[model samples]
Target: MAKQKTAFVCTECGSDYRKWQGQCNDCGTWNTLSEVRLGSSGGSGAASARSSALSGRRGGFAGAVPESRLLDDIDCEDVARFTSGTGEFDRVLGGGLVPGSAILVGGSPGAGKSTLLLQTLCHLARTMPCLYVTGEESLQQVAMRARRLGLPTDQLRLMSETHLESMLAALDEHRPRVVVIDSIQVVHSDEIASAPGSVSQVRECAAALTRFAKQSGTVLLLVGHVTKDGSLAGPKVLEHMIDCSILLEGSDDSRFRTLRGQKNRFGAVNELGIFAMTDGGLREVRNPSAIFLDRSDEVAAGSAVMVVWEGTRPLLVEIQALVDESQLGNPRRVAVGLEQNRLAMLLAVLHRHGGLQVGDQDVFANVVGGVKVLETSADLALLMAIVSSFRDRVLPRDMVIFGEVGLSGEIRPVPSGQERLAEAAKHGFRRALVPKANAPKHAIPGMQVIPVGKLGEALDALEQ
Candidate 1:
């Protein structure tokens, strides 16, 4: 029998080596190298067969192109964007999908990643023909999901196959305008003798499909699986191969989903798309501040309003906190999505400088609407709410509090204070505890805007 051909492959970067190495040469990840069979023909045969025309007399290798020549400008309008049928999805992608762009969508199981894509295709197929390829589930499964979505279009075609070589051949024959792969994990290639979802197969399949999409000038949407820790699965090169990558995130309750762009060659990265989970599908939430506010007849203590900036948008969220005596040596400062150590530090700041007896308290904080807050503008809100909750006092229902409490007991003006106030007012907040520096030159009627320079002043106003 002919000897089997194999090589050591780095699971992180997909770099192949003849001998095992302690660390990946490409990504510098340690202990990621594993042995993988390159099949009977080896990878060289596969590479030659795959790119025979490019490596021909044209000199397909990159060594031929000068570094300066590689930096040439590309057409902007021509490479603009493609409409995905969902307005929010379009917004997050910087208006639309780029022509011939390969985008990866990753999320947890049942996080509505697949549903969102299928809905998008159904909308696009109304004008353009689309093909959906699935390797893990059958065509019937896709059909069932479509029916549940009340979308059964004739232009929407589905294929169930794990063999990427066969899938590529079919794609060449069909030539659809848009292509969507249900997932990349289960897809494999015969060129590499490895189990499906392994590093080699995933890298090979992704490279092949990415090449095909770019060459054919077709837009491809790939649904990827996220690891348990929430990182995108597959080789690191997998993220590099695509033109765009969007991460869909939400709480386990399925009440909301947030689409954030980590990489976007078509537009700006860090763009955000918010969606509310409903029985129908993911509906984009345009003004999240309104949805997050809870206006009632009465105000309660230990409650405060905060502002957080997500990408380019500023949103107002309610912060609720409770404080009590600590039962253990280490007080518990628990935060759902926010950093726990940050909360502990804030508490310490309150005790040391703000004249708060919270050293022995078991304090907890929550950012409403199930979204995480990374901004410290909510610091004052958190402090006030915790104190109120401990005193069992009711805060004014129409009052909104937001500022950064300094160690010297001064109230620091938050960045984008005007915008935050506008959002709070739009949400029907009448009273606001704002930073003294952020106070407008001329006061507007109807709402009471109280500007304070110190945390003690704000506390006195709250007491009144």
Candidate 2:
């Protein structure tokens, strides 16, 4: 009989312990320690055999040792990427998908995650054999959708079964260049002894697929559903198993879907792909600045353009604010698409540092086009918008502002200001409001760069 040994593992962080504990030391979670089987019922010889088998069937013990030694001496060459048809996908992938890479694409429901993957696979399958295995949708449903999308289905295959072993067998026999699992939550592993979508099953199924992808040199894309809180559902280990992770998010109206890279071993993490949903499919927005800047022929008050940086791309965005006298005991402060805490801090700075009395005013601030503005480069624009609304004065045409505002009511220079100015210049912005310290720092011609030291200077400049 094999020796029986037990251990405790935290289900949250995968922390291990020798004995059962009340709480996990890593995450400080209560009651997360669960019994884990270390060894069972006297199988030392079998364990050795299984280890030998994993090391790949040794013709004999001597052969096994030689094979393992040979593996250590072998040097691997870097694999080249398989170019997908979509430029945005290729860019996010740092060119294109690599053979043997396991990719996890996660998103909210109806965020067009499936549509994007389907479109890419459709193009890939026209030349090479590809398989899509789904447990959520039926065969007829996928076929109908594919037909509507005008997908070339000569080499594309679909399977509705989700059993891991059967799926592996199909991959082995079919030898497909690409395999996509519609979702990992719906797949189950009998060895796990847990329901599908549970922590155990998700990890098990994903690990199996990842192993298969690496060994076969096949590209595997797994679609993962997000929880209500916008987190990928499954064990954290699933993320560690995959080579890349892409997150898809959209606004409430679902007009725009942004694909941001959460993890990419081959590229920068901050790179984003913008797409607008259309009747045909999601169309890539090449120039993102045009979508966020809404300017009329006539100059308008309460609207200011800011040069914001998202990753390496610089975009000009419009900010609008409205100030109204409050009748209630507490003024209603609403900030849409911008951080509420940041807005509150800015309001306090405007009052204490800029000599603006907004305590009795209801201020409503919004970043146009439903884009989240996290960079401090947008502060100058927001301040301009609020001041313009307060004075009911229109800002000059073809003017943009981007500078970080300090609590001392001073404008501070922002990083990548020169790059932002160049992008704004490319978009026909003739004038830019920046920090006083940034004077002579940027060299973009065809634009007048005005440096402002304080909010008073900015307000005065706007008046002129």
* TM-score of every candidate relative to the true structure: 0.85, 0.86
On a 0 to 100 scale, what is the lDDT of residue 79 in model 2?
64
Give the winner by TM-score: 2
Whole-model lDDT values for every prediction? 0.80, 0.81
Q: Backbone collision count in every prediction?
A: 5, 5
lDDT of 1 by residue, 164-269 (tens): 8898898999988889888889988877778988877877788788878877778888889998999888777788878899999987875889898889887777
Top candidate, metric lDDT? 2
Put down candidate 2 lDDT per residue, 430-453, tens digits, no spaces.
998999876666467899999999
Off by over 4 Å in 2: 1-79, 296-299, 437-443
